[model samples]
Target: MAKKNSATKLFVLDTNVLMHDPSSIFRFEEHDIYLPMVTLEELDNNKKGVSEVARNARQTSRNLEEIIGTNEESLEKGRSLGIKGNTHVTGKLFLQTTALPHDLPMLAGSKADNQILGIVSYLKNIHPDRQVILVSKDINIRIKARALGIAAEDYFNDKVLEDTEMLYTGITELPEDFWEKHSKDMESWQENGRMFYRLTGPMCPNFSVNEFIFYEFDKPFHAIVRKISGKTATLEIIKDFINGKHNIWGINARNREQNFALNLLMDPDIDFVTLLGQAGTGKTLLTLAAGLAQTLDKKIYNEIIMTRVTVPVGEDIGFLPGTEEEKMTPWMGALEDNLDVLNKTDEEAGEWGRAATQDLIRSR
Candidate 1:
């Protein structure tokens, strides 16, 4: 492979990066990658177990073997990453073939991290015009590299979102003048007692299906985008679950957000729903209400199966004796509390009726 230009970066891989994601080699796109000898040694040391980390290590070894092949000459010169149909990777892969001096002070020379850092330092010196950066998942390694005046960064390919604010909230608030701006050739009708509107405007193309849109102006409109074709979009008014008449299993939504969540949960067309909120936000309550309404009243589903991670807050109370359900009973305090609230929602139901309702819920 020919030498890359100064604009192309050379990334030094740490063992933890490969162990976290084996395909990271192909993820750098046009940037070249370098693997230190100590990184390969660490991969070999960790490839014995059946755990996920071990599996990744073994896979990385396989990928390297396939890239290297039987050619020894290309080992000294960098191998093209695009050799094995990896056309997306336009850069080269370099392996540490010769030993470099590791005389950096304030770092233990015997540590694998230090060895990788030494390779990075040497590469930076050799490639004066090119940018050589160390990509690592370990924070301490990155900090040490920066202290030694080396460029280092975390592997960002695995992160879905760098900022939490970028996450989609599944709901969007329309501008106050949304109706006026999008009313051009707007069509409205009722089908099966559900009101729907079809409108064309500049913003119609940006609407996505199943996304809830609400306007809290004069009419306080709330609807979900049902379809989008060309520059036209169709929205159907969502059911008002906050009304007592439209309550789900004797539970009415206390707020608009909870109503939207209940709408998603009760929609048979929607196969999956994810709710995000802080504690005491009624997430569990709304979910249980919708699930009970669908499973019991509507007969839409046979049962509801709820599971949560068994992680404890503090020191764990180990070794509970019983069957699977019994062992999990200690962690079901939240479920019990929520069920008590749901059972009390039926004001007409007497104490015996509430007990019988609880029995039915537990049976399912």
Candidate 2:
């Protein structure tokens, strides 16, 4: 391939970039697509996996196969008609593939990433005029690309906010008046402050009885929202879990932290919650109370699995071991302490402690 002026650009795609987002190829409608022979090999290896990205990659490869076939010369001349002329399967639409330049760089000794950068270096040497832009989602790939004097960028198709960790906007504490006026329907609260910016339709949907809404203006309080509540509940409600007496000496779930707690607690998909806390953060009590209300009172799930990781202080408690149940006793003993407080606090709460505890473990 002959090197031309910097009038046109050649795009070198990293395998991860393609995998990260399959729409990558279609996104760059104005550039010639270049995938190193090694990248094709990598993609072939990735295709055997059962991931959605693999399937999408396989489909994209098949489409490209029909367009470019195996003709190196046709690709070289930019004569291979594809979904478009501006888009080439082998990067030669604009002085596409060049000969390997100097040997690959000596970074990270023998990483696959380094080998990929080596290929990029060779392509850049052959087509120095056309901008050899390496597109990859891997930070290391872009780092190596730039280190070797090749222009590199993240795959624009790369994503964020796909999982629970990302979309969690945490909790939002509205003033009492705003919350009372808080309608799940955005149209009802159009004049309200920026709280509606994060939400698309309604703030909290009707399907949130198991979920929560915390209120903390001058004081901190919580409400548990029942999504898809049954006939027993006369009120369309999300009750708060707050008892000033029950407050841990130093426990604070305020503002965004409060929001995150509710976000995780009220999350419909997450049936279990485990809060790890130090001395005073009402962790143990809040857990027991919320759990009992949901399992028995509110009737969300059939049982509440309340247990904790017990790192024994020092010497081992002498053996009284039998089955796994007996073996768990030493560890389970500490969790019982919290339940004792809960049971002692509410006299009418029934014989829930041991019964719920046993049923919870047995159900598991």
- Candidate with maximal TM-score: 1
The sequence of per-residue lDDT tens digits that candidate 1 reaches over residues 45-101 is 999999999999999999998888788685767877885578988988899887887
245-269 per-residue lDDT for model 2 (tens digits): 3232222234344434544564446
Query: What is the C-alpha local distance difference test score of each model?
Result: 0.90, 0.56
Deviating ranges (above 4 Å) for candidate 2: 1-11, 15-32, 42-73, 76-119, 122-131, 135-144, 153-240, 243-291, 303-364
Q: Which residue pairs overlap in candidate 1's backbone?
A: none
Model 2 gets an lDDT of 0.56
Provide the lDDT at 16 for model 2: 81
Residue 269 C-alpha lDDT in model 2? 65
- Candidate 2 C-alpha error for residue 218, in Å: 10
Q: Which ten residues in a row have the lowest lDDT in candidate 1?
A: 74-83
**Residue 142 deviation, candidate 1, in Å?**
1.8
- Candidate 1, residue 49: how far the Cα is off, in Å: 2.3
How well does candidate 1 match the true structure, expressed as C-alpha RMSD? 2.1
Task: Give the C-alpha miss distance for residue 22 in model 2, angstroms.
Answer: 6.9
